[model samples]
Target: MVGYFGANLDGAKPLNYDDYLKVPQLINLQECKSTPAHHDEMLFIIIHQTYELWFRLILHECDSAVEAMAKDNVVLAEKQLGRVVEIKRILVQQIHILETMLPSDFLAFRDHLKPASGFQSAQFREVEIVCGLKDERILTAFDDQPEALARLKKRLSSTTLADSFYNLLSRNNFNVSPPPERSQTELWQSWQEKTAKELVRLYLAPSEYYEFYRLAERLIEIDEYTNLWRYHHVRMVERMIGSKIGTGGSDGVAYLQRTLGYKFFPELWLIRSYLT
Candidate 1:
């Protein structure tokens, strides 16, 4: 065990494990709202708290990856994005632990959680925004919480992972900008054609653009794992409550299911279909 203080004579405060981790405060945070607290409520609270902590870390990694990519540091960006992919896998697996609690057991304390829902997790929202999923409606959703709303507003206005990735490509001499004055569909088609051609070139000549090719793969992996996490989360919600409404008045499983179709990097995925 690491000692709190070394034997040196200089007067210094000692730190124990609890002090280092603030374990006392951490353990005390699980306050059960249900009167005659249900046994499963503590488990529910702890699992969700753990998710929020992990979200904080995920956001950190994503922001680092964006900054690295902005500086044309493909290797560092890939490293940070790889960390996010692994963290997403853990997020997918962690939801299963809740399945161990029977639906009836969950209901025993679910009602105690009124109007408060996981839908309002500010950190999770931040992760989505950083990863390139920006929706102004999300800003409206948090209108009641000033701090959370402000953080989300800032993220909404900032450059995202997609912007950084495309910027890196531009720096590498790729013409990623869309043609001017075209209809929305025509612009999309033109952009996709250009991106697909470049991606195919990179795929066929990986040695010529090894760093960029690797960065593209890392980005695709992040998109893949994010969708996987959403898929598993939907199943977990379905298992927990069937079609029942969520604690925050949202369509619980249905809402999660819809999110499964969202992709952070559409051009990356489109390139695969266009590839021979």
Candidate 2:
């Protein structure tokens, strides 16, 4: 028997904040590979661990948004997506915290991270997959880890946030369906154009289609913040390592630069050009 806050609960253990959040175990997880543990290594580990937590939450919210949209609940879907947008803002800011570390400080422990890099974050990849960036090449990186590969495969085959939003538009009588039997990039561009044509109407008369319009705008914000995060991350990496190859053997800054233009909701962005 123990007291929880004030009331007594018989035959039950009281829950403390530390116990509930597993603070002890969580704090212990930042094991630095550097012998003697470089002073900046703790900062490096904690920042990335925090990112994984945020990525998990982002996935949770995105999945909820998808479910909400599937049921034609645009308001709830938008609400969930709004959380993702704000979290992405935090993600952009969070990466900059690494910038405070001197290049010399990071180099003290850099070599210890060979073959392991942010590029290998499976949860982040799942976030990309859930948000509609399905590239099979990413899967090859996880061949040695079956659990992550399985999750990525599930996310790849599942309905993405973009798929849900476009389906919602279709239910509202928009022409989002693809031209039959088209293949490859041509088919992809055609689908984007067709969806963009209808999406433009939402922008033209936002108040008339408030639900769809609001949700679409939220998706755009999410996409925008996603790009912003990528841009900032690239800048941070460039600052920390210059032209050096990544610990994960990636091209580092150059590879990150290539990811800048990715959009989770391309049609929503395409509508902007057609606005006038």
| Candidate-wise lDDT, in order | 0.82, 0.87
Q: Report the C-alpha lDDT of model 2 over 178-205, residue by residue, as the tens digit.
A: 2222236787887788878877888899
Report the lDDT tens digits of candidate 1 across residue range 200-265: 878878899998888888878888887888887788888889999998898889888888888767
Clashing pairs in 2: none
C-alpha RMSD values across all candidates: 3.0, 2.1
Candidate number achieving the greatest TM-score relative to the actual structure = 2
At residue 25, what lDDT does model 2 achieve?
Answer: 99
Q: Judged by lDDT, which candidate is best? A: 2
What does the lDDT come to for candidate 1? 0.82
What stretches of model 2 exceed 4 Å from their correct place?
1-11, 178-183
Please list the residue runs of candidate 1 whose C-alpha ends up more than 4 Å from where it truly belongs after superposition: 1-8, 178-190
Assess the local accuracy of residue 174 in candidate 1 as a C-alpha lDDT between 0 and 100: 83
